[model samples]
Target: MLNERISAAKQIASELHAAQEAIDEVMIRIARLAGTLPAARRDTNMSAIVGQDAMAKVAQALAASGDVRQLLTDAHLALTATQKQVGLGTRMFGAGVKPPSAMFADEGSNDRGVVTALAQAS
Candidate 1:
């Protein structure tokens, strides 16, 4: 039974790592696409206010997506570390971990409301 639990944990950790990688890839693609938008051709007239507002909302959604992706990555890292600590591997926890971003500095503690809003908007 103990062995089975350890195996399941390791599998879950692996899945999380793969998911994080996939999310990173998708985000990169999205960033590239966003960069390709014709900003110079965008209308800024009074009649374009609605379009501008929609664009602003899209930008907000993208930022929220990035925040969620970072949180998932962090969860994946934590899970991977736990799996390693459980004798699943000899590798050290967070051997090549990236530094946390200032954007996510208050993630868990202060962003519940924001996350909820994003979730509802989506």
Candidate 2:
């Protein structure tokens, strides 16, 4: 019985190690795909606007403005925060630390990303 228990423990450890390796592989693949996305979407015509007329120049300037950058930054932050919250909620509930409703309420009072961006702009 003792030898059987030891063998069972070894098998469990081996399975856990295999699961971790699979998780790492998935993470690496996700990172590689994310890295390629920006290059794939890059506009090749970016430099072709150099000889464009005044209206195009103005449009380009507006598009490149700090306000637009800040807006995008805020949106990214909000998305990241939402993702983190959801992940935390999942882990918390899985661990029996909190219920689903409690997790939802935890983020209800925060408009942190927009507020932070607006403050930075000022």
Best by lDDT: 1
Model 2 steric clash total: 0
* Shift in Å, residue 112, candidate 2: 44
TM-score of candidate 2 versus the correct structure, residues matched by position: 0.36
Question: What is the lDDT of every predicted structure here?
Answer: 0.58, 0.44
Candidate 1 structure quality by residue, lDDT tens digits, 20-119: 7777787776666455443523533335354565566556766877997989967865665565566564332222443333122233436556656665
The whole-model C-alpha lDDT of candidate 2 against the native structure comes to 0.44
RMSD of 2: 16.3
* lDDT per residue (tens digit) for residues 17-121 in model 2: 465455556556555554444444454434534434643544444444535445544553453355455443211211222222333323543544554555567
Q: Quote the lDDT for 78 in model 2.
A: 51
Candidate 1 residue-pair clash tally: 0
